[model samples]
Target: MREEIIVSGRNNPLIDPLLHVWHWEIPVYLFLGGLAAGLMFFAALYTIRNRENNYKVAVQIAPMFASIALILGLGALFLDLHHKLYFWRLYTTIRLASPMSWGAWILMIVTPISFIWSALHIKSIFPNWDWKFEVIEELLEFFTKYKKVLAWIMLISSAILGIYTGILLSAFNARPLWNTSIMGPLFLASGLSAGTAMVIWISKNHDERKRFAQLDLMIIGIELFLIIHMFMGFLASTQVQIDAANLFLGGEYTASFWIFVVILGMIVPAILEGLELKGYKIPIVIPAILVLFGSVMLRIIISYAGQASRWLY
Candidate 1:
């Protein structure tokens, strides 16, 4: 009777029955951060390679997206904190071993660079295009006029940020659903897919369209591999992990996991990328949009669902 009572409750259906566990805040952070980082990296890549008339636009837009992610990421962190005022305390000290500390430091470092980079490009909009306004451009030009170097640095940093987002979740060994090392790569891959899709949607011209199409295929392939590994963890892990998997695969959260994550986020993006590869462009755009939105929803569901299931157990 005690066991029966333990598994059944109203609050248990939405939150951890233990009351200490809330919604899946960490997972949500991972998702948004990955998407943001990925978008910034890829956009930087394209800007370097093409140097299209719109290179300035790419620089401007990518940072804006990244900044949005930073804002949302910080908000999520604040919400997760039981005492919001102590949020400043995170920056006051640093712990190398803590993934949260690492993430905070990374965000602190990357966001400013991105903003300055974007601001440098903004001078292009001025009619005179004077060299006086943006000092960073002068510095960037002095060390590396080649956009590719910039792209590579941005790519590497974004990849680190993307993987770090996953690492944050995996660091929590107590959460069976998040303990898998696979989460880091999986999050990085999804970040790429979602980020590339966002760029494709926002981009203009045949060159961008064609280039992003190729990128889409590559991203889809990576995302699929990550999904396979995620499921492999479920198959290979202990009972607690298996039980957690069931929550995503067959229980109350099944609709969200399957509908948003598996189908809309992954499969549709694959199909769309395939169509783009086959020279069908229009067919690909809609699915790209779906995948972007679905990616966001996927994070929300996993975060909430994972915690909710803990309550049941």
Candidate 2:
């Protein structure tokens, strides 16, 4: 006979086997944040590379979606906050060491810039778009004049935002499932892949769509590589990380993560896109939807699984 007692935090849900404090809000926010980051990253990348004319949807149309996604993500994040009103205090000072602080500042800058970039292209989306105020008109000109600078800012911030989504979890060292640094790059690659799939689904130009599909394929490859690398690293590391890895390898999350995220979300999309590139008539929307679906599932699974994992166990 053996008896053991463990004492962690006073009243932490992560310490409790049956309770989850994060709920759906954190996962939703993570998905949306990653999606917004990926969308804006591509938008800024093409704009900087002078491919705006070539990739109209990536540069002009996607930023609007990114802005909307960011706002919705922020709303989800706010809803998940334990103390919502004190959220404003996060902006009172800059904390370089905290991923949450970095995320807050990045969102503050990237969110408005996404909206501004989208607004600058309002004429393209709505030919008769009107400026309701003189100040809005003036602001548009200033943004247009310094659009290159804005793109640079977006590129940097969006990358940070993408990585921050994963870093946020990795920072919680108690959760072995997310305690690895590889989590950041893996999330970024997944987000970028999702973003590219979105542009492929929305673009009207066949050439543009085809080009982005190729790019998406490349990113998907990288994302897959990162996923495998993450598990390999975990298996080779501590017993705790290995336990965490087992949750996806052969445990309860195995089927969902592998089927939804790995097979349907990534491999299926890659095959469809690959066939499309080879002159097949596969509906781009199918692959796009699968990718988006997988992205959402990935975040949700990670959030819940991380909560289930603890050092005390």
Candidate 3:
């Protein structure tokens, strides 16, 4: 007689025939987290280069957005938690191998730093703003005194946060759609591109807008390149991976991915920025809005599509 042992678990809950776990909350959280990371990254970057004052929006304004985005993102994450009361247990220990572990700690560290940085600049953004709380003033003063150190820390933290956004998705090796290392850089590029577009929109100075537009344009180019490479990698891999790529290439996500994410989001913005650089009167907000819209949509599509990429079905 021949005896055989059968594997008990070869199925996926996410890509089941009719069971979907995550909802809108997850994609919203991811988009906002990436956006906040981008804002903080650029804010710290300008401060480190001593160009913060020149780019007032980058330093003063963006941190405020970052702070708000972090709060809202965390709120969205909380809503998606199956065991909401047990969420704090994530802080009890660190797991270097776990992407969720890294993200939890990174988000905790980043949230406070972003809020404090924004608070420090409150006076600068609003001259008439008055709060005479003694302890608060002292804390802000201390943060201001060592702001250079804070900026450096923020630069590193923000970069990690931005990369973490993608790593969270890609680390799920079972999800063939997001199983590539390129997701890290691709998401980072998307975040930086959105951040730069916001800076361009907020800046009142033509030269500042122009400089950031050039930077945004360059990042968009890099983003497109990475996207192409991601597809090439997928197409060259296994059948499941190729099926995953087809989701965006010519499958269900074809129109959404190509039209909203690729064309309107990156290409149109690139064209608008180029025209602006070429002495045309393109409204800066147009490109900025398109970039931001695309960023959020990309997260939503990726989050949803990844869940559908498993071969169990």
Candidate 4:
């Protein structure tokens, strides 16, 4: 009788395995955080540039949504915690080297500023609300008096918040896709794009809507470049990095990445916006909706695909 030999496939011990510890909460938190940051930043800008229109949706309504979005995003982050009760530990210390530490501190500062920004426009949003209450009147007066200063502070803080969303992921070097310096700016652009889309959707001013659409087109263009640059950097890196890049190129996430994020989210919106700019009378809401949806999908795809990347063979 002939001896039979059998071999079984096994994973390489030298390679580090991919981790799926992050889930839907992470992406949702990131998306909402970025969206809030963008909205607050633009609200501040609009307040400073066009104070005459204090009652406009861009100034009053957007800031209100910004505050709400930040609160909801924080709720998601809280839920994502394993020791939800110990969430206060993040605030107990400020580690200069820790991205999470930076994020905690940033969120702490940004949330109040956002609310203050919205509060400054309370009279415009709720004209019928009674200001007869002494404390309520005093609080509103204080915020209104220092509105300019608050706007400047909100702009800076919101920009940091948007950038921090990307930095949070980029700090995780174990994921090759997230380990890039460009991620911060890329995320900022995406957030701004989403923010502009939101403003376009809500603002009643035709000219303001047109301006935001143009701005979004520019942001989307920059994002496209950054994405290509990111992939180029990955391709030029080590084998592990190349493998990580493959996830977007021709691997598991290729179709969704290209279809949803690239084509539908970016290209199509840009085209529609461009046509609207050229007197084509395209429905601004359509492109705005697409951009917003794309922004969420972009965050989801990057969050999942980044986790899928590993150094192991």
What TM-score, over all chains together, does every model reach? 0.82, 0.95, 0.93, 0.91
Q: CA shift at 265, candidate 2, in angstroms? A: 0.8
- Candidate 3 lands at a TM-score of 0.93
Best by TM-score: 2
lDDT of 4 at 231: 93
- Tell me the spans in candidate 1 whose CA falls farther than 4 Å from its real position: 1-28, 46-60, 124-153, 281-284, 309-313
Candidate 4 residue runs with Cα over 4 Å from true position: 1-17, 50-55
Cα lDDT listed for each candidate: 0.71, 0.89, 0.89, 0.86
| Candidate 1 residue lDDT tens string, 152-264 | 76767887898887787678767777778887887787777777777777766556656666776777777777777787778687877888788766778888788878888
Clashes of each: 2, 0, 0, 0
The lDDT, on a scale of 0 to 1, for candidate 4 is: 0.86
Kindly report which residue pairs in candidate 2 clash with one another: none
Candidate 2: worst 10 consecutive residues by lDDT? 10-19
Error of 1 at 4 (Å): 7.5
| Model 3 agreement with the true structure over 1-313: per-residue lDDT tens digits | 8654335754566534523677889878888888888888888988989998688888888789888888999999999999999999999999999998999999989999998999999988799887778899899999999999999999999899889989998998888999999999989889888888888878898878988899999999999999999999999999999999999988999999999999999999999999999999987899999999999889889888888888554
Per-residue lDDT, model 3, residue 107, is 92
Candidate 2 accuracy as TM-score: 0.95
By TM-score, how accurate is candidate 1?
Answer: 0.82
RMSD of each: 4.0, 2.0, 3.7, 4.4
